[model samples]
Target: MHPQIFGVLLLALAPAQVFCIFNRRTWGARTASSPLARFDGPASLVVIHTTNTNPCSIPSMCKSVVRDLQIKNIASNSSDIAYNFLIGCCSGVYEGTGWDYKAPISHNYKDPAIHVALIGKFDESAVPTHMSQSLRALISESQLRNKLKNSFTITEHKSNSSTRKLMVKNFLQGFAEYKEQVNDLLLPEQRAATSTTAKPAVSVPSSKPSSPTTFSTASDRKATFATSTSKPTTAKNQFFYT
Candidate 1:
């Protein structure tokens, strides 16, 4: 083929090329005991979360933490890791359930949404610049791959329980920085809304605790969902137990 033709072909294929994300296989994720549920359509929302645990900056450590998370979820009777993706402090993105499956927390959202968790406790520490950049890149890649809608809205994960306070402070700070950084990618209406505290336009049910268990350690906290109450927004939406 002519050089110009070859150059054009490369340009055309660039959008589909892999980004910095580490897929489940590459991260050594355990196979789900049962097949995960598929999304009905492209995700329209992006939910951000924190691991409430130590951060990992290297690929080996990040992969171990990711695998540990998967194990914990399975032991809790979860189908797999709850988030669709997880970002390490410096290890780039690690795929959780990936783009096709519905996250275990999906029931909390009115529309399909992908969950991304930052692999570290953020209550006191600022989100690392590298982690933030990796997250933004992952979101961009998601749009390019059609895993996320171009107008997808981003929201932070909130815990209804008071015991879960460790994530609130810095998580909010990190979220603000992230929202601003991705302003160009958000829906126009969302971008126009200047208030970081503004409520989500769409309403979803709030997860109700069933046989709730509380842990003194932030890392060990867990809660099971049983029922939900109709809520009028996703912003500051409380879904996690702690």
Candidate 2:
């Protein structure tokens, strides 16, 4: 090739390479670091909910949704890394949602939700099996790790309780749904064979667990934990959200 042409080609390709580096978060990419604020937690499960966003959203735009989730989840004041996993429309795979500051962009061992997308925008009338396949696989893996049953309980995002235990219970319900949705993605035969029959309900203890150090809430948080004693209406309900 001519030297001049080679230089021009490299210049053109440079833009394409930068685009890939920014857009794809699977092999690992990221935008601003704040929205990914949840990476600092010890949580094990990922909850994925597909909003009815404009289907025309390109990959870069879709990442904005991720940033939004991180913002809301943190704004809601839950643990960082709202979910340990994320599955979306890319190739056939799952991507870890939040990241440790150490593993900023790429998903080698640091990320979870490997090789699958749980949701994708498709023709309403006919959906591809890939969506369910990835979804259920991710769920099953989460459940197995938690040692929970396949058909466990799940709460709608709206579910709430006056107490922290109830809040945890509600979160667990979401966890169960995450497990079921992913596990059900298996082939019907596989689902039927692998799926367990008796699933458990929300497993909250009758009383609150031992209280941790408490702090007062700002406008964002409704409840704070200081003293162990609490009544539904008395103690603040400010610690968390849906």
Candidate 3:
């Protein structure tokens, strides 16, 4: 090999870096009466969400938040927590439905998006530095674990038309930066040319057999749905947690 070309190749092939797995536990989770359905198929979208609950920076409070969410989801007759992972302000990541497993989350389009949520609301307060960093890290790990292509779209919950009420207001503006950061981790071909958050949502039919999935709102008591015959349709931009 030519000396100069070999040196260039060495520089291009940097050391592969892997992040530490966040601590995961299910003690606070309410077991779903039935095993979670298999949704571990190939994914290319990641949806970000906030509990929209009181912000809890403390670890104990965060655990309770997770517990309550699981309880709420189960009571609503969901198979389990609808999201694949949840992050506390300081507590790292808590396992939810987990990867490749179907989460009964997305509203309109549901081809290939994975759902991830934060423990507290971020519409008003900035997402703490720790939480934001960890969220990105977790997403990166998720893609690697699922063997997904390096780049996947990251979107906020409110981006969906029917679920605008579920939006985390303050956090919406910063989604572009988040998208850039996520793209930075991708290989050249996989990097997104632009953030897809502002793009209008294209609603199709509910991918699952049930009615359109609803985001958990503050006052929604009966959020669960029985079986429905809604047809499935694909959105223009297949996104996270569609």
TM-score list, all predictions: 0.61, 0.30, 0.57
Best by lDDT: 1
Candidate 1 lDDT over 105-176, as tens digits, reads 665555688898889876556666545545555655555556777565666665433343334434434432
Candidate with the greatest TM-score versus the true structure:
1
Order the numbered candidates by TM-score, best leading: 1, 3, 2
Model 1, 9: alpha-carbon shift in Å?
A: 20
Candidate 2 regions off by >4 Å?
Answer: 1-48, 52-64, 76-78, 91-129, 143-147, 150-242
Residue 34 of model 1, lDDT score? 73
RMSD (Cα, Å) for all candidates, in order, is 17.2, 21.6, 18.3
Relative to the unseen true structure, what is the Cα RMSD of model 3? Answer: 18.3
Name every residue pair that clashes in candidate 1.
none
lDDT of 1 at 7: 9
Off by over 4 Å in 3: 1-26, 159-242
Q: Which should have the higher lDDT, number 1 or number 3?
A: 1
